[model samples]
Target: MLTALRLLACRRAPRLPDIAPVGHVVGCLSPTLLTSLASGHAWAGRLPSSCRVRVPLGDLQCVVYSVYAPLQPSTLSSTSTGPADFDGRAFLNFGTSAQLGFLTSEPPQQPSVRDHAGIDCFPFFSPDRYVLLAASLNGGNVLAEFRPNSGRLARAANRTAVSVRDCLAAVATKPASASDPDPLISPTLLDERCGGGTQGGSVLGLRMSSCRSLGRLYRSVCLGLINNLLSLCPPAALRQAGIDRIILAGSALRRNAVLRRAAALRFDECQFQSIVLEDGGARQQPAVADGAAGLAAQFLDWVAAGRGES
Candidate 1:
């Protein structure tokens, strides 16, 4: 894993490692495990009620809700020996990379606490992305349409022209109407690889007045995205898992205030405290990468302490 990290950092072709004096080697670990460590919240037998909610937006968007909890006896029905049969290698399969299970370094003699529950292909569905897609569908530049004089004014003001950032700001300030449209926009349009027969997207409730209304469009799209996420990992399931705290991470939640507000409101009823990871009033570095680096440091420390000799 360290070698892979080095290659990625250098952005160079992989080459054979030269023979050198190395004290220890670290194996590849799950990103979820690294993220848990990044939070600096220990969960292996301590603070088992906390949950890590990772919403990472890359080529594909995914939301992972992980907790450290013991495996219930009923969860091991397949083996017939109940929790005793758990082998630490077991994962609660949720189709193509979406899984919920105990993540441990070694199989415990009995059912014990473990880390993750991942849901892949879950769209982040940010307002800017949605507007861009909507513009493409209509064959017009939404930003240009919204700000007809932005180009000329920007030149006078010595600044750049209208952008998606402006659109997101508009959405954030404008209050969502009580009678706002539902499912007016489909988030599946953002990613073509989303499975389960949800390839096509919808744009229902569009009207002459709202056809260009960024706020209304944003609200509708945000609701669709949040609803889809909840269906995959419902609040009820989190409650059942004894999850008390939810750590929200992702560029989508951090940049867009409206999206963050909407997510908090949706999960408000669950009574789980939502924490958005930040550093000195700015977005923090990626948790997984930070965690990986932390592990590498710890490994070096272990070697220095003579623990690696074993």
Candidate 2:
């Protein structure tokens, strides 16, 4: 009887605002779309209602969408409800595939890949002006190595773990990055084959070669990953933009202590703060559904505020 009542209540719950007109739809933007936009192609498909833009990009017009629309406003930390220049925030979706982004009033016109020490970082903008970091590595695999497991995934994890540890030990003697005060523990080692600098491979190569046991690699790769992401946003840029709030989302982030620590270590300073999103007993919903729902609500609010203007 209790379950039945709960089900009924769920059904009766109010729906989010309507974004698209009847028969129109919105869905996840594919990687092809991202590639096209990066290549300066015009938008070709159905238009999303809220948090999307079709603006001029040089000679071509492009469309961009927000990836973190599923996160609720309440999940935001110390951000002003009113629009302001420095009130922007950064949201990191830590998952099997992790993503990092910044939320602001205007999406970047042209996105570029940045280099931090030896790591390559790609930044993209969502419909809501959230700039996301698109990674080439499997975040889940990294985590698998961070935690102890007893199966196939564990083996792959071990391989990456050793590489990462060796890379860290090598950089330990080098000069630290300008942004961080700690030694050079980073994910560049995991991507060694993809062009990590010689420093990452040569420094600890000899020492790590003798130590083959996975037991020696204890620190989680999450730290390196988060540190690299934060490096994308330098302190001056963050302070100038007023983006102090950090939102850490993803099932992985909620369950993993190492990931949480990584986030706290990098963001818990005077200039930056972080707030975690709690599911709070809500029924599990797909990220797409949550994002679409939020878009609908924003659309309704926009329409209402316009005095019923279309």
Q: Which candidate tops TM-score?
A: 1
| Model 1 vs. true fold: TM | 0.47
Positional deviation of 178 in candidate 1, in angstroms? 2.2
Best by lDDT: 2
Residue pairs clashing, model 2 = 51-127, 65-126, 65-127, 66-126, 66-127, 86-241, 86-242, 101-131
Clashes (backbone N, CA, C under 3 Å), per candidate, total: 0, 8
Q: Write the per-residue lDDT of candidate 2 for residues 139-213, one digit (tens) a residue.
A: 555666655442333447556444443443443333323442333345544453334445331112223422343
| Candidate 1 wrongly placed segments (more than 4 Å) | 1-161, 179-184, 190-195, 203-209, 280-282
Summarize candidate 1's per-residue lDDT along 1-310 as a digit string, tens digits.
9999997988876467544222222234456675676585554434233332222233211122111112222221111232232232222111111222222222322221212122221221221111000001211122224334433443456565666567567778877666654335655443322244545557777776675465666666555555445544455544543445555444445555766666566666657665565557875522334433333453445557765432
Clash pairs for candidate 1: none
* Candidate 2 lDDT (Cα, 0 to 1): 0.46
